[model samples]
Target: MGIKVVKRHGSSFKDKLYLPAIAGGMKTTLKHFIKNLKDVDNLKTMQYPEVQPDDLNERYRGVHRLTKWEDESEKCVACYMCATACPAECIFIEAEERFDEKAEKRPKEFKIDLLECVFCGYCVEACPCDAIRMDTGIFSFTGDKREDFVLDKKALMKNERSKDLDND
Candidate 1:
Protein backbone atom coordinates (compact mmCIF):
# COMPACT_ATOMS: atom_id res chain seq x y z
CA MET A 1 0.00 0.00 0.00
CA GLY A 2 1.24 3.52 -0.86
CA ILE A 3 0.05 7.06 -0.34
CA LYS A 4 0.27 9.30 -3.41
CA VAL A 5 0.91 13.00 -2.95
CA VAL A 6 0.34 15.38 -5.91
CA LYS A 7 1.90 18.82 -6.15
CA ARG A 8 -0.64 21.67 -6.45
CA HIS A 9 0.02 24.51 -8.91
CA GLY A 10 -0.27 28.12 -7.71
CA SER A 11 -2.35 30.73 -9.59
CA SER A 12 -0.55 32.61 -12.43
CA PHE A 13 0.02 36.41 -12.31
CA LYS A 14 -3.07 37.00 -14.55
CA ASP A 15 -5.27 34.77 -12.30
CA LYS A 16 -3.99 36.58 -9.19
CA LEU A 17 -4.93 39.93 -10.82
CA TYR A 18 -8.54 38.52 -11.36
CA LEU A 19 -9.02 40.77 -14.43
CA PRO A 20 -10.06 37.81 -16.59
CA ALA A 21 -12.61 36.66 -14.02
CA ILE A 22 -14.06 40.21 -13.82
CA ALA A 23 -14.14 40.46 -17.61
CA GLY A 24 -15.87 37.07 -17.92
CA GLY A 25 -18.51 38.12 -15.35
CA MET A 26 -19.04 41.47 -17.13
CA LYS A 27 -19.30 39.69 -20.50
CA THR A 28 -21.95 37.34 -19.16
CA THR A 29 -23.92 40.27 -17.66
CA LEU A 30 -23.66 42.23 -20.92
CA LYS A 31 -24.76 39.23 -23.00
CA HIS A 32 -27.82 38.72 -20.82
CA PHE A 33 -28.63 42.45 -20.82
CA ILE A 34 -28.42 42.59 -24.65
CA LYS A 35 -30.43 39.42 -25.07
CA ASN A 36 -33.16 40.70 -22.72
CA LEU A 37 -33.12 44.08 -24.45
CA LYS A 38 -33.60 42.40 -27.84
CA ASP A 39 -36.62 40.40 -26.62
CA VAL A 40 -38.14 42.27 -23.66
CA ASP A 41 -41.22 40.04 -23.82
CA ASN A 42 -39.11 36.96 -23.14
CA LEU A 43 -37.96 38.29 -19.76
CA LYS A 44 -38.67 35.75 -17.01
CA THR A 45 -39.47 38.36 -14.35
CA MET A 46 -43.10 38.44 -13.24
CA GLN A 47 -45.06 41.17 -11.46
CA TYR A 48 -45.45 38.81 -8.53
CA PRO A 49 -48.55 38.60 -6.28
CA GLU A 50 -50.69 40.14 -9.07
CA VAL A 51 -49.21 38.11 -11.94
CA GLN A 52 -48.28 34.60 -10.87
CA PRO A 53 -46.29 32.30 -13.15
CA ASP A 54 -48.43 29.73 -15.00
CA ASP A 55 -45.76 27.05 -15.12
CA LEU A 56 -46.40 25.17 -11.88
CA ASN A 57 -45.20 21.58 -12.26
CA GLU A 58 -47.90 18.96 -11.93
CA ARG A 59 -45.75 16.69 -9.74
CA TYR A 60 -44.85 19.40 -7.22
CA ARG A 61 -45.69 18.26 -3.67
CA GLY A 62 -46.98 21.61 -2.44
CA VAL A 63 -49.18 20.88 0.57
CA HIS A 64 -50.58 17.83 2.36
CA ARG A 65 -54.25 16.89 2.25
CA LEU A 66 -56.49 14.10 3.45
CA THR A 67 -58.63 12.41 0.83
CA LYS A 68 -62.37 12.04 1.22
CA TRP A 69 -64.60 9.33 -0.17
CA GLU A 70 -67.73 9.88 -2.29
CA ASP A 71 -69.81 10.32 0.88
CA GLU A 72 -67.42 13.05 2.08
CA SER A 73 -65.99 10.86 4.84
CA GLU A 74 -62.25 10.77 5.44
CA LYS A 75 -60.52 7.80 3.78
CA CYS A 76 -57.93 7.34 6.55
CA VAL A 77 -58.16 4.17 8.66
CA ALA A 78 -55.81 5.44 11.43
CA CYS A 79 -53.24 2.80 10.49
CA TYR A 80 -50.34 5.21 11.31
CA MET A 81 -48.48 4.10 8.17
CA CYS A 82 -47.91 7.68 7.08
CA ALA A 83 -46.77 8.80 10.52
CA THR A 84 -44.30 5.92 10.74
CA ALA A 85 -42.96 6.58 7.25
CA CYS A 86 -42.37 10.30 7.89
CA PRO A 87 -38.64 10.83 8.37
CA ALA A 88 -39.21 14.28 9.90
CA GLU A 89 -41.77 12.90 12.40
CA CYS A 90 -44.03 15.83 11.58
CA ILE A 91 -47.21 13.79 11.33
CA PHE A 92 -49.20 13.23 14.58
CA ILE A 93 -52.25 11.02 14.82
CA GLU A 94 -54.53 9.82 17.60
CA ALA A 95 -56.45 6.71 16.68
CA GLU A 96 -59.89 5.79 18.06
CA GLU A 97 -62.22 2.87 17.61
CA ARG A 98 -64.78 3.48 14.88
CA PHE A 99 -68.49 2.89 15.39
CA ASP A 100 -68.79 1.35 11.94
CA GLU A 101 -68.00 -2.37 11.90
CA LYS A 102 -66.50 -2.13 8.44
CA ALA A 103 -63.93 0.46 9.59
CA GLU A 104 -62.19 -0.73 12.72
CA LYS A 105 -60.34 2.51 13.50
CA ARG A 106 -60.36 6.22 12.68
CA PRO A 107 -58.12 9.11 13.53
CA LYS A 108 -59.54 11.03 16.46
CA GLU A 109 -56.94 13.71 15.99
CA PHE A 110 -54.53 14.22 13.10
CA LYS A 111 -52.10 17.07 12.74
CA ILE A 112 -49.01 17.87 10.69
CA ASP A 113 -46.47 20.54 11.58
CA LEU A 114 -45.62 22.08 8.22
CA LEU A 115 -42.62 23.89 9.69
CA GLU A 116 -40.99 20.58 10.63
CA CYS A 117 -41.97 18.74 7.44
CA VAL A 118 -39.29 18.21 4.80
CA PHE A 119 -41.90 17.76 2.04
CA CYS A 120 -40.26 14.48 0.93
CA GLY A 121 -43.66 12.86 0.02
CA TYR A 122 -42.96 9.72 2.04
CA CYS A 123 -46.22 10.12 3.93
CA VAL A 124 -48.16 10.21 0.69
CA GLU A 125 -46.31 7.16 -0.59
CA ALA A 126 -46.80 5.23 2.68
CA CYS A 127 -50.57 5.74 2.79
CA PRO A 128 -52.17 2.41 1.96
CA CYS A 129 -55.74 3.74 1.76
CA ASP A 130 -54.88 6.61 -0.60
CA ALA A 131 -56.06 8.86 2.24
CA ILE A 132 -53.18 11.33 2.26
CA ARG A 133 -51.81 13.29 -0.68
CA MET A 134 -49.54 16.31 -1.25
CA ASP A 135 -50.95 17.85 -4.42
CA THR A 136 -52.81 21.00 -3.33
CA GLY A 137 -50.72 23.18 -5.70
CA ILE A 138 -50.17 25.66 -2.88
CA PHE A 139 -46.43 25.99 -2.37
CA SER A 140 -46.52 29.39 -0.69
CA PHE A 141 -47.52 29.69 2.95
CA THR A 142 -47.03 32.61 5.33
CA GLY A 143 -48.00 33.12 8.94
CA ASP A 144 -47.18 35.30 11.94
CA LYS A 145 -47.50 32.55 14.56
CA ARG A 146 -45.99 29.05 14.82
CA GLU A 147 -49.44 27.54 15.32
CA ASP A 148 -50.46 28.80 11.88
CA PHE A 149 -48.10 26.29 10.28
CA VAL A 150 -49.73 23.36 12.07
CA LEU A 151 -52.40 21.88 9.82
CA ASP A 152 -55.20 19.97 11.53
CA LYS A 153 -57.49 17.37 10.00
CA LYS A 154 -60.05 20.03 9.00
CA ALA A 155 -57.44 22.16 7.28
CA LEU A 156 -55.97 19.15 5.51
CA MET A 157 -59.41 18.12 4.34
CA LYS A 158 -60.13 21.54 2.87
CA ASN A 159 -57.28 21.52 0.35
CA GLU A 160 -58.54 21.14 -3.22
CA ARG A 161 -57.11 18.42 -5.43
CA SER A 162 -54.23 19.40 -7.69
CA LYS A 163 -55.24 20.19 -11.29
CA ASP A 164 -53.42 17.17 -12.65
CA LEU A 165 -54.90 14.79 -10.06
CA ASP A 166 -58.39 16.27 -10.39
CA ASN A 167 -58.79 14.60 -13.77
CA ASP A 168 -58.09 11.21 -12.16
Candidate 2:
Protein backbone atom coordinates (compact mmCIF):
# COMPACT_ATOMS: atom_id res chain seq x y z
CA MET A 1 0.00 0.00 0.00
CA GLY A 2 1.31 3.51 -0.94
CA ILE A 3 1.09 6.23 1.71
CA LYS A 4 -0.42 9.60 0.57
CA VAL A 5 0.04 12.63 2.80
CA VAL A 6 -3.02 14.96 2.94
CA LYS A 7 -2.40 18.68 3.73
CA ARG A 8 -4.42 20.07 6.70
CA HIS A 9 -6.20 23.39 6.11
CA GLY A 10 -6.12 25.99 8.91
CA SER A 11 -9.49 27.13 10.32
CA SER A 12 -10.65 30.59 9.16
CA PHE A 13 -11.60 33.33 11.73
CA LYS A 14 -15.36 32.64 11.11
CA ASP A 15 -14.82 28.83 11.29
CA LYS A 16 -12.97 29.22 14.64
CA LEU A 17 -15.90 31.24 16.14
CA TYR A 18 -18.61 28.85 14.78
CA LEU A 19 -20.95 31.92 14.95
CA PRO A 20 -22.52 31.23 11.55
CA ALA A 21 -23.60 27.70 12.52
CA ILE A 22 -24.87 28.86 15.93
CA ALA A 23 -26.74 31.79 14.35
CA GLY A 24 -28.32 29.50 11.75
CA GLY A 25 -29.55 27.12 14.51
CA MET A 26 -30.93 30.01 16.60
CA LYS A 27 -32.61 31.50 13.51
CA THR A 28 -34.36 28.14 12.83
CA THR A 29 -35.42 27.90 16.50
CA LEU A 30 -36.82 31.45 16.50
CA LYS A 31 -38.61 30.91 13.20
CA HIS A 32 -40.33 27.77 14.53
CA PHE A 33 -41.06 29.45 17.86
CA ILE A 34 -42.73 32.42 16.16
CA LYS A 35 -44.70 30.18 13.85
CA ASN A 36 -45.81 27.97 16.75
CA LEU A 37 -46.75 31.05 18.78
CA LYS A 38 -49.17 32.05 16.03
CA ASP A 39 -50.45 28.52 15.33
CA VAL A 40 -50.80 26.09 18.22
CA ASP A 41 -51.56 23.20 15.85
CA ASN A 42 -48.19 23.63 14.15
CA LEU A 43 -46.37 23.14 17.47
CA LYS A 44 -44.69 19.75 18.00
CA THR A 45 -45.66 19.79 21.69
CA MET A 46 -48.56 17.58 22.79
CA GLN A 47 -50.57 17.48 26.02
CA TYR A 48 -49.83 13.82 26.57
CA PRO A 49 -51.76 11.71 29.12
CA GLU A 50 -54.63 14.20 28.95
CA VAL A 51 -54.72 14.13 25.13
CA GLN A 52 -53.54 11.06 23.23
CA PRO A 53 -52.46 11.57 19.63
CA ASP A 54 -55.06 10.56 17.03
CA ASP A 55 -52.85 11.25 14.03
CA LEU A 56 -50.74 8.14 13.87
CA ASN A 57 -49.92 7.05 10.31
CA GLU A 58 -51.89 4.22 8.68
CA ARG A 59 -48.87 1.90 8.78
CA TYR A 60 -47.80 2.75 12.37
CA ARG A 61 -46.87 -0.41 14.28
CA GLY A 62 -47.13 -0.29 18.07
CA VAL A 63 -47.64 -2.91 20.76
CA HIS A 64 -48.26 -6.56 19.84
CA ARG A 65 -51.66 -8.19 20.29
CA LEU A 66 -52.88 -11.73 19.78
CA THR A 67 -55.93 -12.09 17.59
CA LYS A 68 -58.83 -14.51 18.10
CA TRP A 69 -61.27 -16.31 15.82
CA GLU A 70 -64.95 -15.40 15.51
CA ASP A 71 -65.74 -18.04 18.15
CA GLU A 72 -63.31 -16.21 20.52
CA SER A 73 -60.81 -19.07 20.19
CA GLU A 74 -57.20 -18.07 19.65
CA LYS A 75 -56.03 -17.69 16.09
CA CYS A 76 -52.44 -18.60 16.92
CA VAL A 77 -51.65 -22.25 16.21
CA ALA A 78 -48.57 -22.24 18.52
CA CYS A 79 -46.36 -22.36 15.46
CA TYR A 80 -42.78 -21.39 16.41
CA MET A 81 -42.31 -19.32 13.25
CA CYS A 82 -42.80 -16.00 15.10
CA ALA A 83 -40.37 -16.86 17.89
CA THR A 84 -37.79 -18.07 15.35
CA ALA A 85 -38.16 -15.01 13.11
CA CYS A 86 -37.97 -12.46 15.97
CA PRO A 87 -34.55 -10.79 15.96
CA ALA A 88 -35.03 -9.65 19.56
CA GLU A 89 -35.97 -13.20 20.69
CA CYS A 90 -38.70 -11.71 22.89
CA ILE A 91 -41.54 -14.06 21.91
CA PHE A 92 -42.00 -17.30 23.87
CA ILE A 93 -44.61 -19.95 23.05
CA GLU A 94 -45.45 -23.35 24.46
CA ALA A 95 -47.72 -25.42 22.26
CA GLU A 96 -50.42 -27.88 23.39
CA GLU A 97 -52.71 -30.03 21.28
CA ARG A 98 -56.08 -28.39 20.75
CA PHE A 99 -59.25 -30.35 21.60
CA ASP A 100 -60.90 -29.10 18.41
CA GLU A 101 -60.47 -31.38 15.38
CA LYS A 102 -59.97 -28.48 12.98
CA ALA A 103 -57.00 -26.93 14.80
CA GLU A 104 -54.09 -29.19 15.64
CA LYS A 105 -52.32 -26.99 18.17
CA ARG A 106 -52.85 -24.02 20.50
CA PRO A 107 -50.55 -21.95 22.65
CA LYS A 108 -50.67 -23.44 26.12
CA GLU A 109 -48.43 -20.67 27.42
CA PHE A 110 -47.49 -17.66 25.29
CA LYS A 111 -45.36 -14.88 26.68
CA ILE A 112 -43.81 -11.79 25.18
CA ASP A 113 -41.19 -9.81 27.08
CA LEU A 114 -42.06 -6.23 26.18
CA LEU A 115 -38.75 -5.09 27.64
CA GLU A 116 -36.94 -7.15 24.99
CA CYS A 117 -39.32 -6.64 22.04
CA VAL A 118 -38.05 -4.24 19.35
CA PHE A 119 -41.60 -3.95 17.81
CA CYS A 120 -40.15 -4.81 14.37
CA GLY A 121 -43.39 -6.64 13.29
CA TYR A 122 -41.33 -9.70 12.36
CA CYS A 123 -43.52 -11.95 14.50
CA VAL A 124 -46.65 -10.73 12.76
CA GLU A 125 -45.09 -11.32 9.34
CA ALA A 126 -43.73 -14.77 10.20
CA CYS A 127 -47.01 -16.17 11.46
CA PRO A 128 -48.82 -18.29 8.81
CA CYS A 129 -52.13 -17.44 10.44
CA ASP A 130 -52.97 -13.73 10.87
CA ALA A 131 -53.14 -14.38 14.60
CA ILE A 132 -50.77 -11.63 15.75
CA ARG A 133 -50.92 -7.93 14.98
CA MET A 134 -49.35 -4.67 16.16
CA ASP A 135 -52.49 -2.58 15.65
CA THR A 136 -53.25 -1.79 19.29
CA GLY A 137 -52.01 1.79 18.73
CA ILE A 138 -50.69 1.59 22.24
CA PHE A 139 -47.03 2.64 22.42
CA SER A 140 -47.17 4.10 25.95
CA PHE A 141 -47.22 0.83 27.90
CA THR A 142 -45.80 1.28 31.41
CA GLY A 143 -44.98 -1.18 34.14
CA ASP A 144 -43.64 -1.04 37.69
CA LYS A 145 -41.79 -4.36 37.41
CA ARG A 146 -40.24 -6.56 34.73
CA GLU A 147 -42.93 -9.20 35.27
CA ASP A 148 -45.63 -6.57 34.72
CA PHE A 149 -44.12 -5.73 31.31
CA VAL A 150 -44.18 -9.37 30.21
CA LEU A 151 -47.52 -10.24 28.59
CA ASP A 152 -48.98 -13.75 28.81
CA LYS A 153 -51.48 -15.44 26.46
CA LYS A 154 -54.54 -14.08 28.29
CA ALA A 155 -53.17 -10.56 28.53
CA LEU A 156 -52.27 -10.52 24.84
CA MET A 157 -55.72 -11.83 23.93
CA LYS A 158 -57.31 -9.15 26.13
CA ASN A 159 -55.67 -6.45 23.99
CA GLU A 160 -57.83 -7.33 21.01
CA ARG A 161 -60.30 -4.72 19.72
CA SER A 162 -63.70 -4.56 21.39
CA LYS A 163 -65.49 -5.31 18.15
CA ASP A 164 -63.59 -8.54 17.61
CA LEU A 165 -64.42 -9.85 21.05
CA ASP A 166 -68.10 -8.94 20.85
CA ASN A 167 -70.28 -11.93 19.92
CA ASP A 168 -73.10 -9.57 18.85
Best by lDDT: 1
Writing each residue's lDDT as its tens digit, candidate 1 over 6-72 gives 8665457887888988999999999999999999999979888898556777678888999988878
N/CA/C clash count, model 1: 0
Kindly report which residue stretches of model 1 are placed more than 4 angstroms away from their true locations once superposed. 1-7, 163-165
Candidate 2 Cα deviation (angstroms), residue 155: 0.2
User: How does each model score on TM-score?
Assistant: 0.82, 0.77
Q: Highest TM-score, which number?
A: 1
In order, the Cα lDDT scores of the candidates are 0.90, 0.86
Over 50-72, each residue of candidate 2 has an lDDT whose tens digit, in order, gives 99777765466777889988788
